[model samples]
Target: YCMSPGIVLTNACDSVRLYGKLSLRRCNMDDDDVQWPFEHEVLLSLTHPAGEAEIHLQVDPWRDFGWYRKPSESNNMSVCYSLRSVDLDELTRDGYVFEDQLRIKCKVVP
Candidate 1:
């Protein structure tokens, strides 16, 4: 997983969006012996210092990017989401980010 900061979220002054990526699998789809054959859709719930709620978001990443564990796109896995300012602030507050406020789980899909 990797995170990039300083993403502008809204028209509000000094607001930013946090970008994140999570790798769920690393096997090629053509490999019959691979365990995960079906695509994965991630379900996430983020906890913030301001409040806690399950924000429904599309799992699509920026179109120019491909969601894969390796250089190949023929993998049976994909999912992504956008992060909020309060969540990002809490994550990087002390000049060091240790834990992710987002709790994620996966569900297999065709």
Candidate 2:
């Protein structure tokens, strides 16, 4: 698990300050062209000094592999996850804020 800071802005100059951390656990995946089940979690914390701000999370899979194919064809293989929505306030109330703990499950195919 690692911690990082991110800034999100809503409506022009109006921005809400928040922070989140990512956790990556080892998952079992077969070495074949099939989707495997994987699980992970993300914790976040949002603070609004004015008490009128909204916070959102963006989850993106960071791939560390590349594809190889014939040069004549455009062989571009990339796998990533899009940002998913998670209620920050609800998560915070449940003690799943930044620095806290959370769990997420997913499936990957290759």
Candidate 3:
């Protein structure tokens, strides 16, 4: 698993477009072992108050996993993922001024 941190911003009344880059580290598992390749998935969970809109940028895991595969498994081993909408239109009535900040937690799992 890998941990990445980044900053995102959204317009006060408009749907915010979240865009950023995340670099995942390669696992140190040995090369010649039967488990020569390790596969994992990345899940993004975003939370905001009621009446807020959520948006996401599409990313290709197969291409992103290029740096994580073993030398011999480089072409054959890759990561795959699916985007599941946990919830949408969650009601949030809070208001904030410009420069106001909020926190959301993100995690990557195997």
Q: What are the TM-scores, per candidate, against the unseen true structure?
A: 0.35, 0.24, 0.35
lDDT of 2 by residue, 31-85 (tens): 3543322223332334343344535444444433332211123223322223544
Name the regions of candidate 2 deviating beyond 4 angstroms.
1-79, 97-99, 108-110
Q: Estimate every model's Cα lDDT from 0 to 1.
A: 0.38, 0.35, 0.38
| lDDT for each residue of candidate 3 in 1-110, tens digit (9 for 90 to 100) | 23353433334354543433344344455445434223444444344434364333333356445555444421332233333222112212233212354344444454
Worst 10 residues of 2 by lDDT: 66-75
C-alpha positional error of residue 18 in candidate 2 after TM-score superposition, expressed in Å:
9.8
CA lDDT, candidate 2, residue 23: 29
Instruction: List where candidate 1 sits over 4 angstroms from the true fold.
Output: 1-13, 24-30, 35-40, 47-52, 61-102, 106-110
Q: What lDDT, from 0 to 1, does candidate 3 have?
A: 0.38
* RMSD list, candidates in order: 7.7, 11.0, 8.4
- Using lDDT as the measure, name the better of candidate 2 and candidate 3: 3
Worst 10 residues of 1 by lDDT: 1-10
